[model samples]
Target: MSKLDWHADRGTHPDLALLDLAPESVDIDLAAVRLYRLGRVRAEMNKRDIGAVILSDPINIRYATGTRNMQVFSMRNAPARYLLLTADKSILFEFTGCLHLAEGYETVDEVRPSSTASFVAAGADIEAREKAWAADIGNLIAALVGKGARVGLERLNAGSAIALKAEGFEIVDAQEPVEMARSIKSDEEIKCVIASLRATEAAVADMRAAIRPGITENELWSVLHQSVIARNGDYCETRLLNSGPRSNPWFQESSSHVIGENCLILLDTDVVGCHGYYSDFSRTFHSGPDKPTDDQRTLYKTALEQLHHNMDILKPGLTFREYSDKAWNIPEIYEPNRYYLSAHGCGMTGEYPYLYHHRDFADAGYDGVVEPGMTLCVESYIGATGGREGVKLEQQLLITETGTELLSLFPFEEDLM
Candidate 1:
């Protein structure tokens, strides 16, 4: 048989198995490219007199240094330092508590013996890890900085970056340039997010089809998870497969709730697709044989219709609130006594720049207009907060030239009841 040809009858392919895990090599070049771009940013900051820029933010650290340490991982503490535009170039530190952990490696090949995965079959080797940790970040930053440069602190944070900054380093914040660099999604980021949405959709669909009256919420999560794995996706984010009424919005899972009759299974499995990317969605499945009662039918159809309306209007230049409020026809919303808005953007952390006001964005500063790269989840739900029944139609979409393009499942049915 040809190397390219596979036995259709074979249960699984060896090559496919070998290619399983998502690329482990951190996107270091991506970080470096952003670093080079930071020089111009530093020039801009210099004009602003933001002296001794220090990057306390995790995103900023990753942006300046090609390694994956500090920042969010060490929320209470950041590892090393990266100083751009300083005559010293960049300076990384070996902090006190940071002695034990090895920041991610150069290649997966080196990752085997002491890596997160390998150490798991056996426990991680603290000694080897510390050595690697000490070696990698220092060398990498030195290379980026080009040795013996008069580097000063470029930034610092109150919580994590504090410990590192105390070590005889100057401190500053490149907040503007670093954030500007991180703000826009690159072509590659968009593709990964797009694949993410697809994986999420598949998982949800699988769970929907497999959802049964006797199955617990957790069981449903397992079924969907299996499907995601089959597609080379993962359900690592959000405590998935765990759901209950008292639970927060993003929690979706199974329980002993005994999918009995008359109960509408409310689900907010917002992050059930990929470890790298996530898509937020909600669906209230009718566990038992459900008849579309008059009220249920009206609300479901209205919610679905409202989602479509906003989807039609979701292109560039439309303010965030505009897309949100338009989803619920004000006149109709008032008529039905519905209070919730339609939906918002779905990406990292399940929902960043949360759409539809829910206390925090009361002023809705997210007047940030839709751009082509933005991926939004259009979901409108009402009826659960003491009102009768509820409806939430969720579909992931991206803004496009002519109109918005739907990346999520289509032909959105009104009654998943």
Candidate 2:
């Protein structure tokens, strides 16, 4: 009866759908998550004989200390803030005037004003500023772990690494230690993921509610963005919503094209959601007063089949290469347009240990074991070369001690199925 009332009779109203996904409010134990994450990083460091890890990546900073400030800006604005951690101490070089953000976090031992070395901030004095910033960090490391200790640095510039090396620290790439640590999720971290997914799927339902003929692609995609923010989620990591022909090649961002009577809308929810965990899943919908054409249904069915077959074969201890060997066979026609990864690690964001399709394995695949506590997204995109449309489907799963558990609960398009 109303514009947003598309699915009332099917009990698929956005409000009701959200209630189903999160029937009751969920509470995350922030302290537990923070401490568990910190312990994980330390354990990895110990394995590598690393005495300290210096982190500038906003994501790594959040992972290590559970404190955040202007993350999007800080991602590119190097040295906006950083974290230095040793076996016994944790220090946060917070953005100016943002010290209060980590006031009560037990994982953070000290919050000091960050010394920025960006060219934009320091101009001609950048080299000196880098030296000064490096000196300050060098002093802290010396105080905590002493000089010449092996230190890992993440997402830092080459200049900073040189400076740290000049400070008598043995610099190692921190990405490995950090990612290996993050590969496995703690129980509390899983709770944050579940909460984030509930919010994300609810946002998706609202996006679906707004879909109709003549709605511009941007208009439809905006609904998802608005709903995520409304639920206290941080942001959508990508603008990957597309309609009709744009769905065939994929990777076309949402734009101003108006939807016709029947079109395929594909979306990848790269949502960096609640508590800073990621909720990555994808689905394709049919916007219709007219039923989907035969070709559209074929694509949808093929993708669903690929997704389920791949998902069913996953379990703890499966080697990445072995998974590729057992992965669903892709038909020749769909080979050119196949999704790059059959599956990939998902946590704070799309992460390490990517599993490639069998045909592509030798070139891009690497070896690793899929262990318990890892969350992954299984992906499928089926569209024949030069076809008019495509179908994208993905499912997020958590690997448990027993087997795989489905984490994403968004329903597929039954009509298209």
Candidate 3:
């Protein structure tokens, strides 16, 4: 086997200086960065002729207003917090107890308590409560942009949409503008992602050290979860922890399955790390008292080659369709279980501009250009037609003006290869 040049030195990168500065000397102005982000969003809004935007997506709200409260809860339910961004002002509609939390931020022009009684009214019919909630939101929207004004709305519940239309407002799709603004990350955002990746990689190293036969998948997963939390990192978004046969088809969450001798263990750390940035990467391991079989080694090598090949092809200025045209093609035998895309963008979490394989691009692809300052996750899943296990590998990348930089430094399992 050839020696792989694992880029283990994180300090050599120019960005490392940003991470090493003393708190007093460091040029980390979060407030300024937040203002820059909001400015970018507003610029996009202006280009689209959007008067204001109603943002309800948690990530969008954070990007626009820099507020974090009950984020996970808001993902499934209607957001308890919302922001109305206008040309000259920003108004945050927060839940009653949460209004105080937004007071410290200079980004918000005003903070108002969002009505919660309607959401919790037990005697009221569900439809009535929804109507009441929508009415309140519509009234707020009207106050911000006035009646008959054109507004961009993101993540609006059906009831809210109807109410807003009834209130004589023109609603346009606002998600794309926010996504486009977020797609190109700022230097501070890059730093946050780097911090998260560092923490997540450290946790993975801890898990690798503890890997062996007889340990349950959950136990190993807990080690990673604990390591991230101990470092003051936010919660992981997925439990993509699985071993052996369970790892074949992919997308399996961690379970109580015991690690058997010479079995492959795959883990994807879909963790949200420092400063609310997400670090997503996957590493495949082999539990051992014995070396992996030849087939396992082959699988690992194939996946690693695919990973590097895709990374090499990625750079600034490539269109999504062009990338799809050049992406690695899975063999006919393994095509059935192939993942949806070879790569996807990442920021707050797994997000847009998913670069599809040539085979899947015709039906699943979207058109966009890869620009500098975009961060992407290049993925590889290699499993045979009847194989019991597969190799899963992913690397986070940041597109630079000249080329691309690898953000994730976690080494592949050399023993498995």
Candidate 4:
């Protein structure tokens, strides 16, 4: 009989983090991510020949206006924080109650907090918050007029749109300001992502340790949930504890199938650390004292080799198609007809930037260049149908000028049975 072998693999590469992330919401330098955002906003304004930008997307709010509040969770919260940009200077106008930007003068020029929701509900003098909203954007327009540049809007959410319409201010749709900029990560962002990967790896190790025959998939999932929180991984988008037959289908789980001898435990995983930065990693384990079948060993080793081989090819300036096609080929050589997802973005969301599957005779939407500072979760899977089980090899990677680096280390054994 052979024992299951599990090991830790790198999740995010070192030298990937571009900023100093400490203590979560406080004392962290978001300058890198912020500057990148601002630069993109300005670029959009310049392209549209506009002078100012308005932001409404909550996700991009902190990047442009430096306003990170729980208010983002509430759609009722209007865009009181209107950032006015000029050639010589930029000013931000926000509701005053936000503590994070209470006195960040250089970053946020002016703030006006308002609690007009309950007032509006009562239909009383609810004009205070509304006036603040109108005034903030109105003031931004006035500031831009001072610069003599045609005011342009970099981005805005639907709430901001209503306010702009009420103010009779014409807003230019310039979504290009920050979407692509976020595609490329910064050193600080990479660092936070790496930390997230470390925490995820620890949690996965605990989950793997807890796996045994007779355990329910739900039970194993609970172990993973507890393990991740036990570490620094306080929150996660998905706590996948797929095992047994569920391991074959991608993203399969939420089942009650009990683990028996020779069962396969598939852990498709991720964890959030700083802000929304995340780490995604995957590993597979077999629950059994018996030796792995010839097919299991063959597929597992092939996936592992493909992981390392693809890692060697990680670098900057390559098109997404190049990596997808190149990386996919390695797994194809190993597993023949197995499923292979070369890489995907591992940031604020999982399944980001979409998967790298065959499209139009080649990879699609991957034409974007892989530049330095972009972090990706590259994975390869080998599985059979009808609960035949499978194995997945996944690692978090960051693109650097020199090459690629791994964030967390997962088990690297050729066989796990």
Give the number of the best model, judged by lDDT.
2
Q: Would you list the C-alpha lDDT of every candidate in the order shown? A: 0.48, 0.88, 0.81, 0.60
TM-score of each: 0.60, 0.93, 0.90, 0.70
RMSD after CA superposition, every candidate: 9.2, 8.1, 8.0, 9.7
Please provide, for model 3 over 95-149, each residue's C-alpha lDDT reduced to its tens digit, 9 standing for 90 to 100: 7677776754657888887643234432456556666766776676677667677
- How do the candidates rank by lDDT, highest first? 2, 3, 4, 1
Q: State the local distance difference test value for candidate 1.
A: 0.48
lDDT of 2 by residue, 129-228 (tens): 8888889889888888988999998777677789889999899989998999899999889988998998999999999999999999899989999999
lDDT of 1 by residue, 261-331 (tens): 54455555555343244566656565546654666566566666666776777777777766555544534
Better of 1 and 3 by lDDT: 3
Of 3 and 4, the candidate ranking higher by lDDT: 3
Superior candidate under TM-score, 2 versus 4: 2
Worst 10 residues of 4 by lDDT: 1-10
Q: What digit string (tens of lDDT, one per residue) describes model 4 on residues 1-417?
A: 111111112221121221222334233445555565567666656766666665544445555644445433433554444455654455545455663343432345545443332343325545554455556656657655642334445434444345555665566664554555466666666655666666667777777788789889888878767776665454555646677667766577546888888866777776654455666787878887786787777768767776687777768877766766666454333344355456777665543454464432263454667777767777778764443677877888777888887776876654553
